[model samples]
Target chain A: MRLIFMIAVLAAGLLYTFYAFNTLNFLSASGRLGPGFFPQILGLGIVSMTLISVITEARRMRATTNYFAAPADAFPGSALLIICMSVLYLIGLRLFGAIPGSIVFLLAMFWMISRGKPILNTVIAVMAPVLIYLLFRQLLSASMPEGLIPLPF
Target chain B: MEIFSDLMMGMSVALHPANLLYLLVGAFVGMTIGVIPGFGPAAGIALLLPVTFGMDPVGAVMMLSAIYYGAMYGGSITAILINTPGDAGSVASTLDGFPLAQQGRAGPALVMQAVASFTGGTVGVILITLLAPLFSQVARNFGPPEYFLLAIMGMLTLIVMIGGNWRLGVISALIGFALGTVGVDLESGRSRYTFGSAELIGGINFIPVAIGLFGLGELFFAFYSGSHKKRDGEMLTYDGKSNFWPNARDFIETRFTLVRGSIIGFVVGVIPGAGAAIAALIAYSVERSVSPRPENFGKGEMAGLVAPEAANNAASSGAMIPLLTLGIPGSASTAILLAAFLMWGLRPGPLLMEQNPEFAWGLIASMYLGNMALLLISIFAIPVFVLILKVPYRILAPLVVVVCTLGTFSVNSSYMEMYIMLGAGVIGFFMRLYGFSPAAVVLALVLGPLAEESLRQTLTISRGSFGIFITRPASLSIIVVTIALLVLLPLIQLYGQRVRKPKAS
Candidate 1:
């Protein structure tokens, strides 16, 4: 079943490459290398590798291997939590810059991680990223992206 | 003698006080992260890159070198104690060390592993000093087409060597390759599969995806499986009685294994697609083939313990071949190293060796001394590392997740990457629980962009004919090897199974 799924995906990739190459123009009468020239060649390679993948999948379909096993149920509620944190991080970094954004991400992450930890532990984990960022940006002068609300670099 | 002279020159630069201190710090941090389950040298290197971005090129490389070899030293510790190899590179060590642990010989097993790693590092460093310039000269002969074929070969390598079911490996490689296609096509600047997201114009980074798939995925599965409802075992406690040094007999037997393993490792490392994991596997198999008492392997044999360690450390040295000589990276870790190099405005390739011999040679020298420092530090650090294992997974697991999240977020300061990590983490966890090698995914991600770009360049040069792959001698031969690997790997596996069937009956 998964093989079929993969074949479908491979087919789509090849078809897309074919279509993309057909629609794209060379955009030049002549040059050392035309833009379309590279795309077409890449499309061909993709098509070839995809073909190899299809043949290999078919061969494996005939082969014997155990497929089923117990599925895992670990880390419920983690993805959503991750998504929320990431959104806040995206919004926060611009406002606070590297130091504050990192502090927020780290402390919140520590809270998520520490489970029942005391305030001190949260503060420590939070401080780790912030301190590292300060050391890099201020002391070492490593440049970083300043998001929405820029703090002093 | 030339090797010694070059090495002496290398030491002159490596031993500078500032350089030496970085090496020490790199080794220490490398060991700490390496010994931890689900974190290894690559992640350690990735995390350190942005932090070290401002350092001088030599100092930056000094720390990375320490981490590289130090991780090699630390990998076998968990393999012995917890029956879990911290990284794939150390998996072979577990076959012997874990069994020795079962037999209450963990100390000897660990000591043996550490000694083997040191020897391997010594051999590997020698090869780097002697072989890099020579091999690099050969690598310069490669054109864009050849490098493209090399990446293709890397994909096929994962196809066979992936530890789990072959089907999943193919799927994992496919998905990884496809994901790599998401960003702007280098030749056209046209996005392939980004679905019109401006954020993905640069493509999906393997760093975040790799961290998610390996670190986050593993963490989720550890808790989700619920297999370990009860933790009732004395595996960690009693092993204190075993001697923590390889016996004279072990030394006598394993000396050749270390040498052979390191040599094989360097050769594999030189291969464009093959990396440390493949080298280690090949080393383990070579030792098995050459062992007088073959049945002793995988049953607490010192040869098993030493072969993989030597191979992995040597392969780390091997990876430097491309970086120093050809400018292409053969593995995921090296890819980051490349980025770090570029960050420092130091272009690494053919010109690098010619323009900055001291810098290049100095980096090589650090590994020789760094590996020695790793050996000494690890000996005294084992008792402490074993204690870290005592931390309950309940807390440690979440902490891992958080660190990976923060690490991902901090790298680009893009929360979009953080979300990508979570989604990729889920896919990766399933990939892992299903037996797909995370390294394969990482490899795909690392090489996918380069492969895509090169294939297009070669085609453009060839005027859109498929014959371009073979018309060029170098590209043609590399493709042949990839095909040969794909075909021969299955046959070899079948033979191994057939041979094992008789014994089972």
Candidate 2:
């Protein structure tokens, strides 16, 4: 699993490096260092470092007799589910509104984290979003996105 | 006399009734967050950055500084009672603090920690008041070349000393620098990496990224690791019978240790990359080595507790010097503070005194008051902090998520910021899992634009000659030291390995 994460990270770094290099114009006659120059340097450095890390990890895996001896968190399914829910929450808030979206997001997350203490989760999930909306909108005067249901505060 | 007058003016600004209330609130929040196992000063500040966004600059900074020192004071509670270091800086405290607690002397231990923390924090602030002005004078001579070199040196030292793995640190920093370049170019007036998105023109706000990385990322880690699972073991509690204050004799005996640790911690804090954790460890070892009863060290010795508590608190204060005087953050918390400085539209450096004397002096004055408040709060608020720890992370996570979501969105009232935070949180989680330093990324993100602009300006001034970096005296010295550590030190180590291997063969 650790090896997989390393590989994934390396791939992401490489992909980004390639994209940044191709996207940015590194050469400009106006100055020795252009706007793109720093990003390109960073891109190159990331690729090199990721390569080193990947090679090192690969060697370590080969040398180790019991690969599982290395302590790594078992990436819990619940955690992955929570992450996905958060993504949905963000999108929901974007499309609908902070209040309605927060209610649904909070309910699902609270239930998930509490492992189905439905009554407590429901109570918290309902109350927290409203309280947050009031505090942020009324007290702080924060500009929040208005959606299907308009907020008074 | 001049410094005294400046500080007096600073005190007037800091003592504004509203600022005082914010200071108390900051200390309370800092202490509470410090008591929680997975949260520390950095995360707490990041989470609360939004709250300060609408505040007066002086008041906001005073509150944040309070939080920083308060967390240092509050971190010892869990270390002493539960044998869990609430913050990394308090890990050394657990060696003797937990033992003292187990022996049913938790009150004396707690008192010792508070008193030692007070001593260290006061001394550190004193040194800051004296040294920051002197450093400001030196910083006045720095140009683009010098600033560029200083940034490089700061980054290198952070990677070598704190990141623990140079390769991982480099990768993380590079990724951070890349992220920093996401917005429209200030000089060229051309969008570099926006990829045609209107939102990308404003670039990635460091606050959301910070909150997500340090706050939400840690929450994700706590969940997956199941570290929040309630431990079945009993935690040592105060029985209301023990002395809640260390005896006068104990203080009189350990006075020298507290002063020595404070000096060591302050000096280390002033140095880039040597944070409170290292300061505490070094102070602990120094006290252990020099003690007449060295054998009693780490076996519930008073000196052991005093050394780390004093040093870490002092170091937290000391870390402010570099950030305030040079605009170089020595640690993650200072990096966030640096962001705060930028957000408030005040640049911290030599010119800060001239440009924003009120902000600079007011913050320093507030630190003095904040330390006193922290001492009072920590001593009185220990039970409240202990109770807070019992609140399950399950309930806490949702609250944190909601706060962070609102906070991130409040930055620009942009929902896109929330999405960015979620993505950054996931990346930050994996970065932590893979032994990469999140601090490195953050420091890079904060410093990258400065470094890049300086480098470009230096080159532009020198007509594209790279020699400009090495030709200037200050920049040259910094570059030489950076090279020795990054290149020569590793070469020497490899050569030594080869030499020892031949003898073994």
Candidate 3:
């Protein structure tokens, strides 16, 4: 897992470096340090350091058989589920707007995480959206996602 | 006499009913955020930053700064009660805090910590009041070369303090610098890495990235660690009836410890990258070393709890010196504060006090009042926070996600920023799991543009000769300090480890 993350970073670093070198100028036409100068250094540094980290992490993992062993406390299953749910919630926000999308998301989330409490979940799902709507929209007058399907007050 | 009158003007500003109300709200919110394990001031401030958009700049900054120092007071509550440090700054508090709680001295422990924190915080503000003007006067002479070197010094000191994983820390900071290079080049009128998106043209908004990384990312990691499933530890209860307050011996015995811890914490806090956690740990170590009863150090010693509490609170104050005078944030939380300052069109530097006395001194004065408020809150409001702790992480997780998402959207009403926040959250989760420093990334992101601009200007002035950094007295001084910090931080870390190993064993 660590090796994969490091490799991902390295790949991104390489792409960044490629763009920095190919697209951006190191010195401006007027002979000043241009936009690429900083990014070039940063990109190269990231690529090199990440490559070293990957190599070191890979070597260490090879020597340790239990490197893949999950800790007793880890709940990767639930964590992954939450991530998926969050993505769905984002999609819901796009479709149904802030209030309705948040209501659905909260209902679904509470049902999943805090089971056997429909009454509490329902109350929270309804009230939380209303409260957040009040706080963001009414009180602060901040913009909320009007969504493709706008809601009437 | 001049300082005295300036403070009086600040007091008048801070004492306004509206400003006081904001201060109270910030203090309350800060404490609430701090009580939750895994949620620190960085996340709290980011999560709330957008809400301050319509607020008066002084009130907004006062509230944010309150949240920053207020977290220091709130973190210890959980550390003492549940053996879980709410933030890194409270880790040392758990050493003696939990032990003291276990010994059934939880009440005394809690009150004494509040007192110690109040003392340290107030003393820090006093020092700030006296020294900030002097520091500002000196910092006014700094040129581009000096500023650039200072930025590098901040990053290097942070990386060096990351101990064995210094390479990974560097990589994390590099990632931040990379992110910071997004958007149009202000100088050359060329977009660097925006990929031709209008949203990308403005570069990444700091609020969403901050909220995602520190808020959602930390929450997700907490879930991954099975914190939601784990039942709370047996809480040591303290009814306000009996044995609640500390005895006279508690204060008398630790009289010198409080002073020593405050001074150490303040000094450490003034240094870039050495934050409250280091200050607390170093104070604990120093207190132990100098104690007549070293054996009693971690065994529910009043001084043990007092030293770290004092140190962490003072360190929080100490960190403000750089931010207020030099416009450089030494830690993730302060970086968010800097972002807030910029959002309000208030650039914090040497001229901040001269140009915006009302905002600067108003903030400084609020800290004095804030420490008093926090002391009262920390003592009288314990039961409220204890109730907060009873609320499980499982239920809180989704609501937090909702807040982070909606908060991101509220800032610009832009779906793209929300998406960026979500992406950053996922990436931040992986970063946390893999031992990379998210704080370092955020700090670098804040400092990257400043560092780049200053370096370019320095080179331009020097005709592309880097020797200008050595020739300038201010730049040379920064170089000497950076080198010294790079050499000294590792030794300090070593000493902290040496002291910590015994307690761990």
- RMSD for all candidates, in order, please: 5.1, 4.4, 1.3
Of the pair 2 and 3, which is ahead by lDDT?
3
lDDT, model 1, position B22 = 88
| Weakest 10 consecutive residues of candidate 2 chain B by summed lDDT | B495-504
Weakest ten-residue segment in model 3 chain B by summed lDDT: B232-241
Q: Candidate 1's residue-wise lDDT over B61-148, tens digit each?
A: 8898687668767877888888777776787677677877777777777777777788877787777777787866766778878878
> What DockQ number belongs to candidate 1?
0.21
Per-residue lDDT tens digits for candidate 2, residues B186-213, read: 7777687677889989777898888888
Q: TM-score of chain A for each candidate?
A: 0.58, 0.74, 0.95
True contacts kept of each: 0.17, 0.66, 0.79
User: CA lDDT of each candidate?
Assistant: 0.69, 0.81, 0.90
What is the lDDT for B79 in model 1? 82
Which regions of candidate 2 fall more than 4 Å away from where they truly are? A65-75, A115-123, A145-153, B231-242, B480-505
Candidate 2 displacement at residue B377 in angstroms: 0.4
Model 1 error, position A71 (Å): 2.9
Tell me how each candidate scores on DockQ against the true complex: 0.21, 0.60, 0.84
Q: In model 1, what lDDT does residue B362 have?
A: 89
